[model samples]
Target: MARRKFTREQMIAAARDIALHRGAGRVTLEAVAEVIGSTKGAVLHTFPNKLTLLEELLRSMCQEWDRRFDEIQSKTTGDALSAYIETWEQSDPQAPSYLEAVAVARAEDPKLLEPVRQAYQRYGNLMQLDGPIATDALVAWMACEGLVLLDLLGLHRFDQTTKDAFFSRLKAIAAAHNGEGT
Candidate 1:
């Protein structure tokens, strides 16, 4: 009988699907192997441990965010704050699993979140380029982060109208800080 072959990307994709559908806590080497129709050894070949797998998943998520940020920043004429706000606004708020990667990484090992922290730091540097308005941009970015955290934790009490209004205000603040008016 021929052994099933699974690529590293296939294992990561399986892990991501499990994390997104079942929950990050449910993502394990065995789960990923099963999802990919391969043995645990195959997954282990690429991801030595579950923590490594989760870290890779988290890193990949951050990379995707960076890609989106670049695309949006270009469209916004290099307005980092506006790009950040638009990226958050455009993401699916209902899909809390996107943030679940952070929770999983923290649970496994706080240091595993280095990729996430690095991504944020990169964005923070860009926000600082606004010079005098950097403070306002930082404030807007902080607000967006807080809102996302609240939503991810299911602690937000905002109705659809309130959520829309909040995001509208966030966009207004970003625009104002970027010198595009409210």
Candidate 2:
């Protein structure tokens, strides 16, 4: 039997998938290599250490969001807000699981701090928002993030009704910001 060689990209993706399934602290070079059919030494050759791998995965996650936000922003026909809303409501699957992992790792590792900060900064940029526009969109984005984290932590349960009301309020905020008098 022969071991597979994973590209830097494949290894990172596998690491992210592992973290999402088992949670961040449990993710290890061995775990990722196992998932990718490679070896711990193989992963180490690519990434100097776990923090290095996690940092890259975290950055890749942010870049993915930047890409997706650009895609959604390009659609200009109907309410961009609606597209934005849907984009985020379904973003976890579309984006990497690294952000959720960051929340989990924040209290201990602290290596995650910079990447998550950079991610949020880029997020504000990608939202195509500035000044007051930035305020509303940032709040909305944070609200979505907080709710998603709460759900992930089993602290908050959102039924369909609550989801609808929250989204409705978000849309109304966007509309108001657009000066449509929502």
Candidate with top TM-score is 1
Ten-residue stretch with the least lDDT total in model 2: 76-85
TM-score of 2: 0.78
The number of clashing residue pairs in each candidate reads 0, 0
The TM-score between candidate 1 and the true structure equals: 0.85
TM-score of each: 0.85, 0.78
lDDT of 2 by residue, 1-182 (tens): 77666899998788777666677776678888889887899999999898888777777776776566557767743445545665566575435644565753563388677867776665555456765566886677677777777776668778978888998888777676656653
How far out, in Å, is residue 164 in model 1?
2.4
Candidate 1 per-residue C-alpha lDDT over 1-182 given as tens digits, one digit per residue, 9 for 90 to 100: 98978887788788878876676688899999889888889889999999889888887777777777788888876878788888887777533333566876776678887777777778788876466676777788888888888977678756779878888888888788877884
Q: What's the true lDDT of residue 171 in model 2? A: 72
Q: What does the lDDT read for residue 134 in candidate 2?
A: 60
Task: Give residue 152's error in model 2 in angstroms.
Answer: 2.5
Alpha-carbon error at 75 in model 1, in Å? 1.2
Screening candidate 1 with a backbone cut-off below 3 angstroms (N, C-alpha, C), the clashing residue pairs are: none
Question: After aligning candidate 1 to the native by TM-score, how far in Å is the CA of 133 from where it should be?
Answer: 4.7
